[model samples]
Target: MNTQEHAVGQVHRDDISSRMGMWLFLFTELMLFGGMFFLYSVYRFTNAEAFHIAAKELNTLIGCFNTAILLTSSLTMALSITALQKDKKKLSIFFQLLTIILAFGFLVNKYFEWATKFDHGIYPGSDTLLAMESGEILFFGLYYVMTGLHGLHVVIGAALIAVMTRLTAKGIINKDSFVKLESAGLYWHLVDIIWIFLFPLFYLIA
Candidate 1:
C-alpha cells in the first residue's frame, strides 16, 4: 500500500476515535441528569397531590413556547451541520447565528418565568416556598435545580456555537474539518432533549 493511502486511513481512524470520545463524554452527561430525574420521580411518586398543585401554578403557555424555541434551534443546528457538510460556509454561519439567537430567546423566556415565580416568593429558600407542603416544596426545588442547570447548558451551547461561527468565518472549520460543528450540534441536541423531558414533568402534571 502507498504511504499516502495509509496516512488517509489513519486520519479516518482518528476521526472515528474523536467521535467515540465525544459520545463517551455525552454519556456521562446523560447519567448526571439521569440521576436528577430519578430523584424527581421518587419524590413525585410519594407526593402526588402537592406536586399537582404546584405544577398548576406553573405557566404552561410559556413552557410550551420555550419548548418550541429550543426545538427550532435544534433544527437550525442540524441545518448548520448539513450546510457545512455540503460546503456551504455562508449558509452554515447563518444557521449557526440563528441557533444562537434562538438560544438567547429561550433564556429570555426562562428569565421571565423564573421572575414570575420569584415575585410569588416561590424560590428555593423563600419563606413562602418553605411554608408550602413538602411535596410542593420538593417540586419547586427540583424544578429550579434541574431547569437552572439546563439553562446553563443552553448558554454554554450558544457560546460554543458562536465560537464555531467565528471559526467557520476564519476557514478553520470548513467542510474538510467540520467535526467541531458536529460536536457542538450534538451538545445542543442534548440540551433540547433534556428540556423535552423537563417540560412535561413540570408543566403537564394533570
Candidate 2:
C-alpha cells in the first residue's frame, strides 16, 4: 500500500476515537449540570413569584436569536469537519470562521442586554437589588451566575476554534481535524442546550 492509503486509514481511526471522546465528555457535562438543575429547581419552587417576574423582565426575542445563532454555529462547525475529511481545507476554514462569527454575534447581543441592565441598576448587588423585593434579587443573582458561566464557556470554545483554525491553515492538522472540531461541537452543543432551558426560564416562565 502507498503512503496516502495508510494516512487515510489512520485518519479514519482518529475520527472514531474523536467521536467517542466527544460523547463521553458530553455525558459527563450533562451529569454535572444536572446537579445544578436540581438545586435550581429547589430555589425556583421557593421563589416562584420572583422568578416569574424576573422571567417577564428579560427579552425573549433576544434569547431566541442567540439560540438560533448557537444552533447555526454548531451546524457550520460540523460542516467544517466534513470538509476536512474530504481534504477540502479551504471549505473547512470557511465554516470554522462562520462559526466564530456566529459566536461573536451572540456575545454582542448579550453585551447590549447586560450593559443596558447595568446602566439601569439592574445587576446583582446594585442599589436597586439591595432595596428591591427579596425573591426577584435572588433570581437575578442566579441568572447572572449561570449565564455568566455559559458566556465564559463560549469564549473558551471560540478560543479553541481559533487554535483549530490556525492549525488547519498551517497544515498542522488534516485527518486529525475531527478531533478538535468534535470537542468543540460537544461543548458548543452543551452551551446551546443550556440556553434552550435558560430562555424559557428567563423569558417565558409565565
Candidate 3:
C-alpha cells in the first residue's frame, strides 16, 4: 500500500485499539462497583431495620435533586456526541459545557448533604457514629464508602469531559475523529448508571 493508505490504516487500527482499551477499563470499574454493591446487599439484608433507619436520616430531597442533575448531565453528554457527529462543533461544545455544569451542581448538592451529616456527627468512624448500634454503624460505614467513591468517579468523569470540551473547541474532536468524546460519554453514562443504583439503595431505601 502507498504511504497515505498505510497512514489511514494505522489510524483506523489505533481507533479500534483505543475503543477496546476504554471498554476494558470500564469493565474493571464495573467490577469494582459491582463488588461493593454485593457487599452492600449482604449488609442491608442483615441489617434491614438499621438500614431503613439510616436511609431515613439521609436527605431524600437533596438525593432527588442530585439525581435529576446527573440525569440531565447524561442527556447533555449524549447530545454533545450527537452534535459532534453532525458536524455541529459549537453545539457540541455547548452541550459539553452544560454537562460539566450539571456535574458541578450535582457535586455541590452532594457536598451540602454530606456536610449536614457531618454536622450531626454521622460520618463514618466518628464517635457519634461508633456509639450507634452495630447494624447502624455498618449502614453508615457503607454509606460513606460507597457514596464517597461514587462522588470521586463523578469528579473524574467531569474532568475528562472538560478535557474533551477543550479538544472539541480546538477541532481535534471533530466529526471524523471523535472517538475520544464518545469514550468520555461512555464513562459519564457509567457514572450516572452507578448513581441510579446508589440512590435507591442509600436514599430511597426508607
Model 3 has a clash total of 0
Lowest-sum lDDT 10-residue window in model 3: 1-10
Which of the two, 1 or 3, has more TM-score? 1
The CA lDDT at 67 in model 1 is 97
TM-score of each: 0.94, 0.85, 0.93
- Tens-digit lDDT track of model 2 for 40-110: 78889999887887777788788888888988998898898889989899999999999999999999999
Predicted structure with the largest TM-score when compared to the true one: 1
What local distance difference test score does each model get?
0.94, 0.81, 0.92
Error of 2 at 190 (Å): 1.8
lDDT of 2 at 128: 84
**What is the Cα-based lDDT of residue 13 in candidate 1?**
39
Q: Poorest 10 consecutive residues of model 2 by lDDT?
A: 1-10
Best by lDDT: 1
Evaluate model 1: give its TM-score. Answer: 0.94
Q: Which ten residues in a row have the lowest lDDT in candidate 1?
A: 1-10
Query: Taking the tens digit of each residue's C-alpha lDDT, what string does model 1 give over 1-206?
Result: 23333355434535665777888988999999999999999999999999999999999999999999999999999999999999999999999999999999999999999999999999988999999999999999999999999999999999999999999999999999888889889999999999999999999985
